[model samples]
Target: MNSSDAVDIATDALVVIAKISAPFLLVVLAIGLIVGLMQSVTQLQEPTLSFVPKLIGAAVVIALAGPWMLDELVGFAHELYQRTPQLLEG
Candidate 1:
């Protein structure tokens, strides 16, 4: 309703998004780094060698953390819905 309210909502949404995505992002980053190190050591320089592991790492993170991510998203949505009336009244 107000600029401050809108900003708060936007910030909360961004935080939810970051919380949901962080695990996958961190896992992929770590996997990529390790793969890069291995590639350098062996001088393989294969693209897929780097990509596949990162992809798999991301997928594994998603699979492991999917329920928690869903809970965070659902909680955020529920909070927003609960605030809708107050927001509208303003």
Candidate 2:
């Protein structure tokens, strides 16, 4: 309804997005570092070497956290829905 409310919604949405993305991002970053280290140790400088591990790591993170993430998203959606009328009134 106003700039402050809009800003609050945007901030909340960004926080949720960061929370949801952090695990996968961290997993991929870790896997990438490990793969890079291994590549350096073996001296096989293959660019694609990092992709599979990072992808797999991200996939595993998604598999492990998918349900919880979905629940969080759904809860946020519900909250937005519940607050819709109030926001409209404001």
Candidate 3:
């Protein structure tokens, strides 16, 4: 395929990746921020304190959103596969 087709495929793939990971990333970010604030206020600078909550939050988010993420990924893969013939001919 030409440059534009390649770019389009790359863009689609990136979008799918971002969409799939966003929930986990956002949950982790929120947890980290909250834990950081708590640490600052309480003067408890234990590294593992922050890690555990963020880990749990990420796991919870993933458990809750896993099916939706899978669906999005599957849809993207299906679309890409469907476009393979056109991409090949280009």
Q: Which pairs clash in model 1?
A: none
Using lDDT, give the best candidate's number.
3
* Comparing 1 and 3 on lDDT, the stronger one: 3
Q: If scored against the real structure, what TM-score would every candidate get? A: 0.95, 0.95, 0.94
* Residue 2 CA displacement from its true place in model 3, Å: 1.4
Count of steric clashes across candidates, in order: 0, 0, 0
Model 3, span 57-81: residue lDDT tens: 9889888998999999899989989
Question: For all the candidates, what are their Cα RMSDs to the real structure?
Answer: 0.8, 0.8, 0.9
At residue 48, candidate 1 shows an lDDT of: 81
List model 1 lDDT by residue over 1-90, tens digit each. Answer: 899999999999999999988898889889988989988999999888877787788788878898999999999999999999999999
**How much lDDT does each candidate structure score?**
0.91, 0.88, 0.91
Ranking by lDDT: 3, 1, 2
Q: Superposing every Cα of model 3 onto the true structure, what RMSD results?
A: 0.9
Candidate 2 on 46-81: residue-level lDDT in tens?
Answer: 998788888889889889999988988998889888
Which residue pairs in candidate 2 collide?
Answer: none
In candidate 1, stretches whose alpha carbon ends up further than 4 angstroms from where it belongs are none
